[model samples]
Target: MSKTILITGASRGFGKLWADAFLQRGDKVIATARNLKDLQDLSDKYGQALLPLQLDVNDRAAVFAAVQKAQQHTGRIDVLINNAGYGLFGAVEETTEQEARAQMETNFFGLLWASQAVLPIMRAQGGGHIIQVSSILGLVTLPVLGLYNASKFAVEGLSETLATEVKQFGIHVTMIEPNGFTTDWAGASAASTTPMEEYAGLRKAFSDSATPDSFGNPAATTPAILKLVDSAQPPLRLLLGKVALPFAKSVYEARLAEWDQWQEVAHAAHG
Candidate 1:
């Protein structure tokens, strides 16, 4: 059976790769990018299997309208992939108010609107999958990229809550927590704050931590994602890169240890 999958940010990166894969496999794909021109190649290649829409995820009304149009086109949307987000690279102090709000508007609220828009359609259909493209940074912290981390963390929280709330409606939500990948996330798609001289050392350390091996190939993630979406019972959260699990484990362990060390205070606070 061919599924209807709607993906945001389909112009490039994982969204484009996944959209092509689905279309190749005979699924109906409604791909959205900020510019329809960017999706011209896919539209040309896939023909009717591809529905490319120009969308700025930051536009709330447009998101709802787009999703409604997609539902009308396919009759039903089997899956919705929220991949329209970018990274804001900077230390927290260096980030401006406008930059912070812009990050939340697109990365957080954009996703929220898309999810909200699809819920009614999926509910009427009795079942559907919603995949949120989050980051490992959502679960852990890193130097610089503070606003980006905050946005993803918000994504994680919202998706987790949504998963539990919608399970009864036969709606499944999965958060794809990927580590660094060979996407333009840190390049073309990224916004950066002005560099501060005081945090120069911290910035250098952050740069040094990212070796060539730290990033995964975007194309290589196809198999895992396919398996996930095809499963009878998919996980609420899926890590997309080799390093994501181990890094998350280490981070969680440290968090647990710190909590345990302050166990007395934690218990006392409840009093």
Candidate 2:
């Protein structure tokens, strides 16, 4: 059955790809970005199947308003893809408090606001799925992007708890953790704070290794996401791409080692 799906940050990157994939599959899409004009081409092609809206996810009132408007048009939203966020690049020490908070507003708080606005709608509609566009950085980390990593880590925590909390309502929450994609993610979509000379070695390492497009094709993720939407029992987390799995495994492995090293000392405080 065709569903009403809402996609935030639909102007570019994974969000745009997901929008295209869903519309092609005959679903009704409400695609939003800060710049509604960016969606005009999609609107012209999809016509009534697409409703393009200007939405800034950080605005709590606007988030709720957009969801309400969407519900009025479709009567129910079956899926929500939260893809409205950007990567902030800088060493942790290099990032000013303002830059850090701005990073959180869009990456962390934005997701939180969208989820809050949609939950009641999903409940009233009897059930739905919320797909969070997280990253492999959520599971692990690197230099320069520490703030961005922190934001996605928050998303991982939020989505996991959301999954358990919303199960009774037939709602599903899946965090889509992808490694670097061949999208505008590394260029225009990413913001860098003031660079610290002290972190030049780390910056060079990041540049040489994790420069986004160096990963591979991002189109590979669309089908997996559709699978999640079609799933009768979707997992709490869906890691995408060739790099995603290995990266996740390594992170867990390291975490296990660290836990093993600290378990006795950590347990000592439990009393």
Clashing pairs in 1: none
Clashes of each: 0, 1
Against the reference, the lDDT scores of all candidates come to 0.94, 0.89
Instruction: Report the lDDT tens digits of candidate 2 across residue range 11-114.
Output: 99888888999999999999999998889989888999998989999898999999999999988899999999998888899999999999999999989998
What TM-score, to 2 decimals, does candidate 1 have?
Answer: 0.98
lDDT of 1 by residue, 178-204 (tens): 999998889999999999899999999
Q: What local lDDT does model 1 show for residue 188?
A: 94
Error of 1 at 125 (Å): 0.7
Model 1 regions more than 4 Å off: none
Measured against the true structure, the TM-scores of the candidates, in listed sequence, are 0.98, 0.96
